[model samples]
Target: MFMTTDVTDLAAVRAEHVRHIATTLRDVRGPLIPILHAVQEDLGHVDQADVPVIADVLNLSVAEVHGVVTFYRDFRRAPGGRTTVRVCQAEACQAVGAEALGEHAKRRTGVGFGATTSDGAVTLDEVFCLGNCALGPAVQVGDRLHGRVTPARLDALLGEAR
Candidate 1:
């Protein structure tokens, strides 16, 4: 059974919801990652409230489940903004002023990485790579990717997202 809780309701992660997710995927080999992904996909973030429920259902300790959640950058502990802006911070991107661009983004949006804007319009994230190494300073605005991005280009992207 899918969670009846609203998708945007991070705190609505009920034990039954986690139980359903865990039970459905339990038979799979090494099910932790997949289950976590499913939960995030469904709930926007892996609420800490659901960790113990998942652990109990999967017969694992809460620490194990929490460890996996914390270890992976893909899992968010809080609700993300309506839009996600990921800046490539890998060596290649950094070589081309990505660091400066990242700073500009944070300053412009008034939020650090892993934080959402005050208006809830955007979430700033740092990504190690976007595989567009040839075009350093790559960035992704929602589903679309751009390369060789400057601070101005990032501003346009954020504007569009807003």
Candidate 2:
């Protein structure tokens, strides 16, 4: 089961973000992208309410704003479920079987890439790199990164989070 936030309040967040984005547009060339990124960074995700605000502020069609939002994988328009589990899927990690480790991690957490558990205790994320190539097959729980995460090791990692 999934629980989403109230859309009405999200609209308010978007409205304010739009105003800020408009200011950025005047100051920057491709204001919409940066503004959206900033909003996501500050708010964790972009709110739907801001689409109209962005469109109006950037002099873009609402559809255009929506397009840019969806185009980038980094931009999230909703909140993360709860605990974030980032599995390194970069080449360095994969060289040491990170792909298989990621698959196991997802199954162990009961959530796929970009998904959260029913209890909202965990959200699984796929990341390309953690700059810990030496520690291939790395995973980051919250902000702590772990290396050489085998299936057995995953249980230990999950234990720390729980």
Candidate 3:
């Protein structure tokens, strides 16, 4: 789940963490994405406090780091819940009622796409594809893939996740 900290504490910790991460990966060619990914992997999301530290270490502008973070859908700016629920929204899945399924998932989870539940139990996301086209309306819950997910099935999954 996204971490909640006092603003001052968060800034202090984020700077140290971001600096170490950037320093470790600075020698690599085009280390931007890898460094950001490392930060996200460690911290769950890339905090705004991280951007300036990362930029300074890499000798780049804060805008550059911010741009990359914003451009990548995989990079979360805020913390996600304990479980991530991704529903495929690709053309193949959509052809099989994925849209309806997506809506159902959102309503059932009480959050729209890219949102985590207040209880920090689940995060709902819309994905382009799960590479399970044959099984339309595919969904990936955490690391497990399931296909042909009906609204009832989605509810069951959410129940299980909770």
Provide the TM-score for each candidate, comma-separated: 0.86, 0.76, 0.89
Winner on lDDT between 1 and 3 is 3
lDDT of 1 by residue, 1-162 (tens): 775766656445455777799899999999999999998887778888889888987899999999999999999998899899999999999889999999999999999998999898999999999999998899998778899898898999999999
**Tell me, what's the RMSD of every candidate?**
4.6, 4.9, 4.0
| Full ranking by TM-score | 3, 1, 2
Query: Per-residue lDDT of 1-162 in model 3, one digit per residue for the tens?
Result: 796779888678778888999999999999999999999888889988789899999999999999999999999988999899999999999999999999999889889999999999999999998899998899999899998888888899999999
- lDDT order, best first, reads 3, 1, 2
Candidates 1 and 3, the one with greater TM-score: 3
2 versus 3: better TM-score goes to = 3
In candidate 2, how many Å is residue 105 off? 1.1
Candidate 2, clashing residue pairs? 14-50
Per-residue lDDT of candidate 2, residues 85-134 (tens digit): 88999999989998898888888888799987787777789999999999
Root-mean-square deviation of Cα positions for candidate 2 versus the true structure, in angstroms: 4.9
Total clashes in model 2, counting residue pairs 3 or more apart in sequence or in different chains: 1
